[model samples]
Target: MADSASRAVFLLQLTDCHLMPEPGQLFRDIDADSQLRLVVDDVLASGLPVDHLLLTGDLVHHGNAEAYRRLLDILAPLPGKRHWIPGNHDEIGAMRAASAMPCGREEVDLGHWRLLLLDSTSYPDGRGSGSLSETELVWLEQRLAQSTERPVLIALHHNPVATDSDWQDEIMLGNAADFTDLVAAAPQVKAVICGHLHQSQARSIGQARFWCSPSTSVQFKPAQADFLLESGGPDASPGYRWYRLYPDGRVESGMRRLAQVAPDPELG
Candidate 1:
């Protein structure tokens, strides 16, 4: 890792890989493993400086231990310290068991800033909806108070802001207002990055920006009233997000998308 005191720390945020336990398994008709590999290949080809790899969530669709292990294997070639949070599809215990890296610790010190990983899957209302628990809220408040000087960047599985897609909006962070209230009060908190909507998006609350990245699997069509899977074209592609966080509280983020993936015709 680069000295955060000297310069900016580059963080790569890859979300929603959705890998299955089986080696050649496909999720939603997409070759989940191959798609992730493509993204990995792109990252290596880009030759980006990566200080930490922050996987926001949904590393595996099956919640199997092997899948989590596989995730590490696939991402092994990438450079940086790795961190991750669980998504709705992940089983916490299994993930912790399977992970070679630290699993339950929520905050990581990147010198100038502290990255906070919240548990949005604490309260799953089934059908993919998630909310932060009261206990988690208290923990967040304490962490914020403990390090008021360090700029904060929060990562979680669910979006804290609505995506405007009716199906996705209903399943967004359930206690968003409460979450927003706390984040709004903290001026040092710079951004919130998430993964569930399966498409790249950015929104805001107060001084904080919310960045939602596309899945490494398949993407959901944005700005829709009904649930719709992106079938073809650029929108259906597998992609990831990256951010360059500087010591002076600057966060630069962008999306890197692989070639388009056509939806499986057999499912239809």
Candidate 2:
């Protein structure tokens, strides 16, 4: 529930952790566990009251039970309800079994705002692209119809629009037109937040805005023709996004990154 006095809901969005079964494992020259720990530490230390933690997707590097256990252990201390969706790298069944917290919730009510969680990884078998089933689209319409007055924010694992990066765009939501068309028709829809691009991107389609957050472990270079990692520069550090949702249907968001890079023992 949002604080009635402030009329604002504070949310933390953490995505693409890519954690491994072992705490010391590395992905793309970045130590996944160490990076995740750094981000989690900063979020808790900020002393900001968060109402919800929206884990967009890619919770693990490999779809394994042990990896989910490690992820859960790292995020144990964070307060608030956590809602998650599956990415290509996640094993849905394994994640549900490993998590003590709720895993896949389609809709959540936060005061006057409603959050819809969609599973874009319809074919979860190492495929980079994503799609929503017919049933999901129908459910989305029903949900939107039911709450036309409340502001809605949708979360999914894949980008619903082009990132201008040819390689990344190819793997984005396959049925983006269908999805966006539905969103465009809904005046109550405020934002669509997503992951899997591994970089921050923002675009506006009609009245709705789409946002993609950077990964907690590594970030990919944006607007590239091919797959590329972001060079270890000041702007390329692992990070998360914070959102402030107001009662009047306004949303404010920003990204936060650690000043120090996660220690990569393998590089040493």
Candidate 3:
């Protein structure tokens, strides 16, 4: 049986990689592949015994099969049980075909906590906005019901709550109210971790804490009225979130960025 004894489970969240099939291809003027390499290297060097790596989404820029395959190649050496979900920019079919990693699962049991991965991508309309279908909602509720005794950490692609950036808020989860209502009802839920804003943010709503991890490639500027990209300088380095989930239902988390990564000259 999975043990939730005295030890803490180390998990890492890497989001918005935006990598392309080509090695030097740039997304928003940032060399996504290089940045991802740097981020992966940093995580390895950190000496953190990461038990699981939660990839929150936007793994690739164009949703290409080759891109996903390339990403798998790049992250092949990372030591953890890697799981990913789809982002607005990702093609679900391609991602699934390219990797053996499960995309959306009802729950992933980690010793003391249950990690739920949700699909927030809205199809046909093809906008940035997200939605939880009726079926997904039912699935979520069922999972929550079954895992009442375990602390739950939900992972989705888009932020379910407002990030204060008007443009980003518009693109966030369309059914966030419904989503949060379920979360609020489930006392076992400890946190909701996500990506898509490309910037880091943490906020508490009722019992659940919501956290947005910075992108592994380029980051978007926060709290802006309109769409704005982070300046490619010291202020906007690529980063990931580190999570330490304790056996007693407590979570310790923080963001870590590459120390000396310079912003792309063109983006600057």
Q: Candidate 3 deviates by what RMSD?
A: 5.1
Score candidate 1 by lDDT.
Answer: 0.84
Tell me the RMSD of model 1 versus the true structure: 5.6
TM-scores of the models, in the given order? 0.93, 0.92, 0.92
> Compared with the true structure, what per-residue lDDT tens digits does model 2 show for residues 224-257?
9999898868658888887778888988777777
Clash numbers, per candidate:
0, 0, 1
Candidate 1 ranges beyond 4 A from true positions: 1-4, 260-268
Model 2, position 4, has a per-residue lDDT of 74
User: Could you give me the TM-score of model 2 versus the true structure?
Assistant: 0.92
- Candidate number of the best lDDT: 1
CA lDDT, candidate 1, residue 250: 84
**Worst 10 contiguous positions by lDDT, candidate 1:** 259-268
TM-score for predicted model 1 compared with the true structure:
0.93
Best model number under TM-score: 1
Candidate 1 residue lDDT tens string, 1-268:
5454868889998988988878887898888899899899999998988999988788898657877888889999999999988888888887888876655338899998999988888778888978898988998888988879889999888888877799888999889889999999899899888889899887777898778888889889999998899998887888888888888898878777876422211111
